[model samples]
Target: MTKTAEAGAAPARGARAVPRSVWALGFVSMFMDISSEMVHALLPIYMVAVLGTSVLAVGLIEGIAEATASIVKVFSGALSDRIGKRKLLAVVGYGLGALTKPVFPLAGALEWLVGARFVDRIGKGIRGAPRDALVADVTPPALRGAAYGLRQTLDTIGAFTGPLLAMGLMWWTANNYRLVFWLAVIPAFVAVAVLVFCVREPTLPAAARPPKLPLRRSELVRLGAPYWRVVGIGLVFTLARFSEAFLILRAEPAGLAPMWAPAVLVVMGLAYALSAYPAGVLSDRRPRLDVLLVGLALLVAADLVLAFAPGLVGLGVGVALWGLHMGFTQGLFNALIADSAPAELRGTAFGVFHLLTGLALLLASVIAGALWDAVGFQGTFVCGAVLAALTAAGLLVLRRKA
Candidate 1:
């Protein structure tokens, strides 16, 4: 069957039934996110308060680590395409991430912390593209939107729960950040165990595999205009969104205690988990671009609220909107990439898409950090709002053109 016809075909399972591998993958993602967030929730404060790092430094570290992951995805994704061994690479990636868990609690210096984060993100980079491609490979395209949404929802559940766990541990340990970090190790290993034992790779016959590197010009040409359009939109969306570290920072002005800071992410994650699946379903039923516009609108509203809000209530509203934007956009973005890319090149398509967005993210974060240092917290979010507005306008025009 033609790629389009295959994608359009009725799902192998009913509307409510997703493949076991996808569920397993979602669980793996959930456990890892739980592990990661436990650290991430406290990491900004750990840097600023314990380690004596500046906000700019925190932004730089986050941007660089994430950008490194982005760069790695291009190679890892293409390699999986060439070797036809997605599961092995994914296992290695998850193992590497799991191994890095201990480094968090043990770090005595900034270099050690940075090294741990760098290595950890590399594992993320390695697994991300192939895992995404694997989801596309196993699930019917008709169900792609919901599949991505379900995984995201599960992941967000972990994302929020980890912070809540961290908050409790922080209280129980008398704000012992290191001890919380130590406990996070448990979930990371759980994620690895699930991936290794529960998830099975779909087999592909030798003849069906692509012969050359996925990045070669001839291969990329096959990705075509629609794929490129999605890539462009992704870059713009990323430019409007910076690292969430700033949100935690924003909460401080409203009298949120350092130990309670993770509550910000908890709120965001709750909103994200609740909304992601429905947004994915909405995207599947409506025009994808329209769904994207709704997401953009939420982000713009979030930025505005964060920029002007004076107290905790406003911050809560803004953070919740930010999460809502993530819920609305992130999974749908993955589905759109799947919709546009050919089956054979899905991994590389995700890689290239992520690469550009990563670069944009680096730029956005840097700008936000600089703004925070120069003009204040308000400047940072106001800039984000303006950028989001511009991007939304541009997308509206482009959608019209199309």
Candidate 2:
């Protein structure tokens, strides 16, 4: 980084603890994730017992939601640069998501459930890139990995808490799913309130910002070769990996208890939380190739565990490993985008990355659903394991090519 770039990063730096604004941003993510995961963690039960939803429906909702977030990311990120405010949009996104929380509690039909999901994802799409861009805006270059890691750590912590909360509610209410969902609104409201008051965005150069309008030559815009390769890794990996919801859904058919749902999810979230920040800090010096390789290998091993695991203990191990691998790479993957892509295009890069990855997830889930219907849980996982291996193999090829 140049002297000027170093100067540009000054605002992001504060006292050793990280600025109150940034930590608050982490809180916002923490609480919102808690809210979303509360419902998402237990959704499998609601679908299975309450609505009698099929695997295909479960897959479709997630696939659709991710696809929605992707589209919003492309334009909203660009728009934020013009508005010169990442913080406000983030608050709006959080607020929107919170507002929709009540819908699930009121929903009586699966379609309404899907509709609530859509509204919530719309909030996600609006907030994601701008929020990330805001973090970059305020964070010093040297702390980039640590900052993103901390943010990811907090986010996954919410994932951990949300499920445990859900589990408790389920047990306490004697399986009153609706009441548990109603309680989700509290954390979400807290997240939005935090964002509104505390998080701050530092003003920076437009080049250092996400673009305000359509990119001058978007398709032709250079996303550096190394970054492009990183995106490829994400895409292939996403193709192999289905959503966590699907994983939980898959476990159910194996006779896993609904009450045990939150426990497994808690384990996965803990694995993700423990690894994300360290992975980010490590990625700063360790070379993405090396860290990425280790992560891919871990995922391959995870898939193998899932493919062959005959019971709950084995299944838990596989899920936990999968979460660990994801934590190791998830935030690092975004940091890689920041490193390799130009500042003006960071949002585009992320959006494009999500587009490909989300689309792949959509396809993977849908395809997995069909396979599950045809051949059952084990068969679907056997296929997933093969695909994960293929994704790992692709990474090795990229390493050699680079």
Candidate 3:
């Protein structure tokens, strides 16, 4: 079948259907990312300089947010399947998060800021997996790469713009964090509106899909024995992959100034944005495993560069490589999960995938931070390099067997 025909065809196994309206869902993500990155990029500054939150507290906060989001994802997806309304849930998630943005400006105490972050994360956890399932539902297996890449590209573009806008706002306002935060609310609201009016929910198979049995009892295991192996490989790869906070930390130690960190990120994001569409196209043409393995290798090289080399040049190379990997892997990940799993359980699968990766990232970041304190940057990269190398090897072995 042609790609378009394939997209409109029925899911192989009575999976709940996705509507064509689902395709434009990327706009929602795009707007959300813009709003999110704006706040996230500035949050450390606000917390440390303004609220005096310690590094440990920041880490704790991150862990809590990610773990909460990751764990809740499966439930929400399953619930959406049960309820037969991805649009409603998507609206709820986006709306709730947008509503929480004002809290940052309203927060006078450290506890209040934490509460705001928690609320925002709560919204994210609620909506994420269901959203992915919607994308999968509407598009066919062949189109999965394109759909996800389009979504990610939109999202990454937001990431790129949000920080730049925040910087401009800060410059305009003379670095008034409160004013900038309040302004963020505007975009958040716009995003909620887009999801509400613009995006349509995918159509589900008519018999009213049943709720997924909880974690241990999921029928998804029918995908087979080797399914678990892929999950394990994913987990190991995630362990080596830490937070991008490390990127900021690394760049500064190189010739990049601390204040210029966002600019560096912008550069990296631009690279990521440029490469994503082609990577997605590649995933569409070949096995997702190959594309994703290529991304891992690029990441490994980036880590190695971060460990050695001269000032600005080394930092640029590392950041660029990281961008390439991000481009390659993120979109390909969706393609892989889509290709490998039954459509009925897509949301649940993505939820599990994100949860594992998020948890791993949280742990890796903490460990890298501790390593930085004790063994310094060199030790940290050495460890990351080893993990990345192992990840690349594992991916290759998996491909060979395939």
Scored by lDDT, the top model is: 1
Provide backbone clash counts, one per model.
Answer: 0, 1, 6
Instruction: Name the regions of candidate 3 deviating beyond 4 angstroms.
Output: 1-6, 9-23, 211-218
Query: Model 2 — TM-score against the truth?
Result: 0.92
Clashing pairs for model 3 are 17-203, 17-204, 18-202, 18-203, 19-202, 19-203
lDDT of 2 by residue, 111-158 (tens): 888889988988998888888866665666666677777888899999
| Pick by lDDT: 1 or 3, better one | 1
- Model 1 ranges off by over 4 Å: 1-9, 12-15
Q: Rate the local accuracy (lDDT) of all candidates.
A: 0.89, 0.78, 0.74
lDDT of 1 by residue, 1-402 (tens): 123222434665433566778889999999999999999999999899888999998888999899999999988888877787788888999999999999999999989989999999999999999999888888876688888999999999999999999999999999988899999999999999999999877765565557887899999999999999999989988999999999998889878889899999999999999999888878878888998999999999999999998789999999999999999999999999999988778888888888889989999999999999999999999999998899899999998998
In model 2, the runs with Cα more than 4 Å from the true position are 1-20, 206-212, 216-220
Worst 10 residues of 2 by lDDT: 1-10
Candidate 3: what lDDT?
A: 0.74
- Per-model TM against the reference: 0.97, 0.92, 0.90
Error of 2 at 64 (Å): 1.2
Global Cα RMSD, each model: 2.1, 2.7, 4.0
